[model samples]
Target: MSNSLRLVIGEGLEHLEAHRAGAFAGDPEAIHQARVALRRLRSALKLFRRHLNPSARDGFNDALRALGRTLGAARDWDVFVLETVPAVMAVIPDQAEALGALVAPAQHERELGHVAVRALLEAPQTDAMLQDLGSWSGDRVAFSPRKAARQLIADEAGPLLDRLAKSVSKRATGLEEQDDEERHGLRKALKSLRYGIEMLESLHGRGNTKPYRQALSVLQEDLGRLNDAIAAVELVHRLPDQPGRLVIEAWANERRQEALIELPAAWHQFKAIPAFW
Candidate 1:
């Protein structure tokens, strides 16, 4: 388990570092990948919480979470300017010019957002945090020498995956009727469970986990699109109130409704899958 933890954390760190230059260059996919690496690292920490030192775990969790928020802000704008705006333009062709004009300032905001991401990436504090995480994952005293830490992952992976799966199931109990916050809660749970499965995939094999992962990917896509719509609402409000703003909001609302209608069926399909572990 301890060795596996080290491997997982190391992989996350490597994944995160791989995208730094691309994020600095304002590549949306790079920014998204970096954010995902952070999420996977945090999820790994939580997944292995029982075997970790509390103080070390909490500090790293807090720091990583702060970093995630910084990246997330930039990501939201990238989606809005790059994806959502283009999508709206395609769907509402007559309003394209007006919508483009309304979103011009949003493009500037996205530039500033990338600048902020660059600054954080270059910050000394971030370097220090990453160094500390590497040290911890390398067994350099950040993690306590607990019995649980020494246990074999082969004996532990199954129950951990099972617990994570059950958590997701519990969160999805009333999928279609869930409020935005509740649905967001489910999304987080699903992400954690998915990450858990991903981390342990080597043990379970791609053959065994592939179908389950595919199911998770589908459900997450729906949930993610819904989240984007909700975020678009909040983001559009930040723009100057204008006629096009109402159009964008309506478009986002329509997207939200579509996702809501499909969510229950997706949730059921996901629930029908047996726990892979």
Candidate 2:
């Protein structure tokens, strides 16, 4: 087997093992990391599909996708509470009283996260899928490098780009809504675009995809900041009416509006890149 193939499989197995151990211990971070590893492994498999048996590859892909979805919601909520919410609260001290309201919800999300992690850890499907991945990874296969690269671009990268383009366009259309949920969806779309571009760059040469990838990176960053501001505002909104809460809300709103204005031009520039779609 090529070094590239071996490296991919080894990394994947490591991630799977880590995830399994973490989930068994009920570690939220481990569960999230495991999902990320599965995603990376799935991407690698797609990129190198030509070297794998079709039946086995399909099975691995399906299993990963299912597991990813099962864990994704819990991870999203965890991130919101543990990372985004706390960070926002820290920045807006005046809104501290209002921010307290979110603690309950955040704690609730944490409980759900634990439950989701436990369920996935205990699932028989997890063991079967990991075993299948191990067996497939150990199998020797031959493929023409050039042919495999071309197939990867055609089958995986092309479709991913199409999906990313559609997602961005859809998100852009809804930007005018200017609500926490709408902006959150936009952030998710930007993340998808960013990851898709990164995956393509890994398969294709970075030189060929740099402009588009950089554009995506910029868009993702700007949108992410904007989403953060929106979430901050929502946090304040949830607080009991108070003088300090109003001040925080106003600050957050100002920041959000500025980001909104900055985003359109950045988005236009990104869309203008020839390979962005």
Candidate 3:
């Protein structure tokens, strides 16, 4: 367990360094990979929290959360401009100018967001906090690593899996009437549950966690598509009144309705997966 934590933190740190260097270049993959590394490290901290000193664990978690926010904001714009705009454009070929109008300001937003994230990464405490986390990767006095490897799957992982499963099952009802806030809430909840499952990946060699993860991925994709559509609608709502705005609204709504059609079955498949912990 200690070795695995060390490796995971090391991998995340390497990616963080890469992202920090390339942030101003506005590379989408750098933004995406860095956020992913932060998530993986956060997931690790959550899993092995019982093995960390309270101050040590809390400090790292809080710092990572703050860093993730700026990076997340930047990535959202990147997705909207680079990825989502093209799809909307394809849908309304005649309104290509309309889609570009939306994409332009978002691209500018991405540039501004990238600056904010770059400044955050260069903050004074940022380096010290990352150093502390790396040291934590090596610190194992709270629990014996070998003993944790033997018992953690049942004692720690199983209960979280059970709780998240119930939460998803409960929140997933009445999706058809759900507002934007409610749908976004579901997307975040499902992502948390999926990340929690991923934290226990090392323990799954003797079990069937892969299929369980696969089911969650499908559900996540469905929720994500819905979110992109909603974001499109919101962007169109923000644009200056023009004839093209109506066409863009119609295009986004079509995509959203299709996702609403697909969500229930995906949610059901996720709930039916046998718990793997």
Candidate 4:
């Protein structure tokens, strides 16, 4: 079990490093993938927390979270400029010129965000942190050598996945009435559940996991549309006051209403899917 934990953590590190160059170059997909790697690593640690040394685990979690924040800042602007703005532009063709002008400020902010990403990548602490984590994953001190550490991952994955699934359902109980913060909480829970399923997919086999994964994907997409609206308002407000900003706020409100109307059906569909694990 200890060896299994090391393998999983090592694979996460490898994934994180693989996208380093692309993320450094400010590629949107790479930045997203890099952020995902950080998330998977953090999820893996929490999934197998009982088997790890608390002090070392806390240190690694803190470092990974800091890196995640840096990547996330850049990713938010990427989604704004690349996805949200273009989406609005498509619907309001008459405002294309106004929307196009808005892109410059968002892009500038994005570039500044990427500058922070680059700085973090170049910082000595980043390398040291990764190296330390990589080493710790294999170190005897990192593993508690408890009974749980000796159990097979397959035996444990099902319960771990169940907990994550329940977390999403619990947060989603009053979905329609949830405030932005609560809805945001549900989104986070959904992501964790999805990641948990992905991490354990090999254990369950693709045939068994496919239906649940698909349902999860659809539910996530619905919630994401709603989230994009909420996020769009924040991004637009950060820009100077202008007509384009007003246009975006109105567009965002429309998107939010549409998403809210569609959310219940999507949630119900997701709820009906049987647990694959």
**Best-matching candidate per TM-score:** 1
TM-score on alpha carbons, each prediction: 0.95, 0.61, 0.82, 0.95
lDDT of each: 0.87, 0.67, 0.74, 0.87
Two-way TM-score contest, 1 vs 2, winner? 1
Mind giving the per-residue lDDT tens digits that candidate 3 earns over 102-209?
766667787888888778877878888888788778666534445554454446567666676676766776877888788787887777677667555544543667
After superposing all C-alphas onto the true structure, candidate 1 shows an RMSD in angstroms of 1.5
Model 2: colliding residue pairs? none
Over 1-277, each residue of candidate 1 has an lDDT whose tens digit, in order, gives: 7678888999999999999899878899999999999999999998888778899999999999999998999999999998888899999999888788777889888888898999999999999999889888768365568776777877888888888888888888766667999999999999999888888875455556667777888899999989999999898888887777888899999999999888887887877778766
Point out the higher-scoring one by TM-score: 2 or 3: 3
Instruction: Sort the candidates on TM-score, descending order.
Output: 1, 4, 3, 2
Residue 258: error of model 1 in Å? 0.9
lDDT tens string, model 4, 115-232? 9999998899999999998888888789786887777878988788888988898999888888889988998999988877777764445556777778888888988999989889
Q: Candidate 3: minimum summed lDDT over ten consecutive residues — where?
A: 141-150
Best by lDDT: 4
Per-residue error at 203 for model 2, in Å?
6.4
RMSD of 3: 3.4
